[model samples]
Target chain A: MSAAATPPASSEESTDASSPATGRIPGNRAIWVGILAELTEFTLMFLVYFFARVNHPQMFHEGPRRLSLLAGSANTLIMVSSSYLVARAVLAMRQDRPEGALRWLLAAFVVGAGYPVVKFLEVRWNLEQGLTGGGDVFQMSYYYLTFNHLVHTGWGLLGMAWVVVRTWMGAYDAKNHNGLVAFASYWHATDLVWLMIFPLFYVMP
Target chain B: MTALRKIDLAWALLVLFTLTGVFLGEFRQGGFWVVLVIALVTALKGRLVIDVFMELGEASPVLRRLVRGFGLLVPALILVTYLWGPLLARFNWLLE
Candidate 1:
């Protein structure tokens, strides 16, 4: 059924946790526990990046120049776009349009999948340019941070795949879609991490 | 505005801000002010993702604050480290 055909959501009718008007958790509490852990892990990693940069100002300044600007920019675009699509998918579900939600989710998965590919090419190019994990402190931090983020993104991509299958099977709808919402929260958190990482490594050097 | 339209707006602004950061980084020389501006931009981007994309604006106060604190704290830390990095290094040396 199209969202256009569904009646507008009434406050009296939406007493559930998923109601957009209420000050409720977007997903379940468990996923938030995981999100907090993820945030903590990244915060520690960011501290490491800052510490290394402080100690090696010259190397930090030179690092971004040696890297491929296009790769970094492309990934940033990919991440934001993918995040937007997933968000749209959730909104589509909220609108009670399962087919629309599925379409948006599949689009998000395809875009999110590009992240690993771009990262692979970027790493290969870096290796060709003599930027290895053992090269210097800057390279070490870059590899450590970005690769960690890549791993998280890999998890998020897998989650997206699972949710895609669920959506196809009519497992989610407007009222009881905690699974989808939890996955969206997770994917958004991953995207948030990437936004911070992008400037730290590529833009700010 | 419709919720979807609001998210669309947030997406547009996110892309615009990202491009702005890249432009500044590419064109401007590294300096105290440039570092400060970049840090601020990073903070703004983080807030957008939290409040808009994550849809945490109306959640529990503690949960909202915790995430928002992160969005603000990291950039503040970045700026602090940028300005006082040498001093921090010395402090570390002293501890060692």
Candidate 2:
């Protein structure tokens, strides 16, 4: 997510009285459900990762050393920065600024596109270093979890593409930008997951 | 500060925190202190993203709590696992 509403999102934007959002949850009911499911899936996988680490401490410890920390960190910065841009896009729409929102989302797409690019390089590097899923417990967990995240991020990028087109066509005004919010919600959730993943797989000491 | 400016500030802070995490990983090595610090930072960044970026800062109580709970939960779980890793590893009797 990017910025806040310079003012506040008017009440109409948050139509569902049951929604604690008041202007929260960016997207619609459906999007929140997806976000919830995604988070839960990751939570379970992270647990699996922790358990694997516990069982094979030495592997987990040495595994990351062979992986590309620079690539991981670069991706972290890319994810966070893109997430910031997405938030700004949502905020821009809420303030009746479709052009600004569109611009932000475009920037977000460009930034977000970096994730796969970096991951490609990282994977190539890992392969060269012999870090395969079949290598050991830690490497297996790392590959599975990170690859899972990459797949989800691919979905997010596709969503962003749709959002970008709609946004460009003036499909989202301040009065109705649920699409923007919904996409941002997914993007932000992905960012949150990456934040956790980064430390676990790359930066954990 | 404007919301955009605040977000920019948060972005800078997050970047700094991320770099610090990398440096800590490079210099610190595995230990309880490192685990605790990393988890704490992770929790903090999660809260910031939830509160500001996700716009739950002034949201309803339930929404606030949900996001807040998730923000705290991930790191807490990691920290707990880190603290008792060996003790828990003892249960590897079956797998071993």
Find the candidate with the highest DockQ and give its number.
1
User: How accurate locally is residue B48 in candidate 2, as Cα lDDT from 0 to 100?
Assistant: 73
**What residue pairs clash in candidate 2, if any at all?**
A1-A87, A2-A87, A2-A88, A21-A24, A205-B30
List residue ranges in candidate 1 displaced over 4 A. A1-21
Q: Report the lDDT tens digits of candidate 2 across residue range A41-90.
A: 88889878887888887887777788788998999999999999998888
For residue A67, model 1's alpha carbon misses the true position, in angstroms, by 1.1
Off by over 4 Å in 2: A1-24, B92-96
| Model number with the top lDDT | 1
DockQ for all models: 0.51, 0.48
C-alpha DockQ for predicted model 2: 0.48
Model 1's interface RMSD = 6.2
Error of 2 at B61 (Å): 3.7
**Residue B12 of candidate 2: its Cα lDDT?**
86
For each candidate in turn, the TM-score is: 0.92, 0.89
* Tens-digit lDDT track of model 1 for A1-205: 0112223267553543323643567678889899999999998998888888888888988888888878998899899999999999998898899999999999999999999999999999999999999989989999998999999999999999999999999999988788999999999999988888888878784
Which residue pairs collide in model 1, if any? none
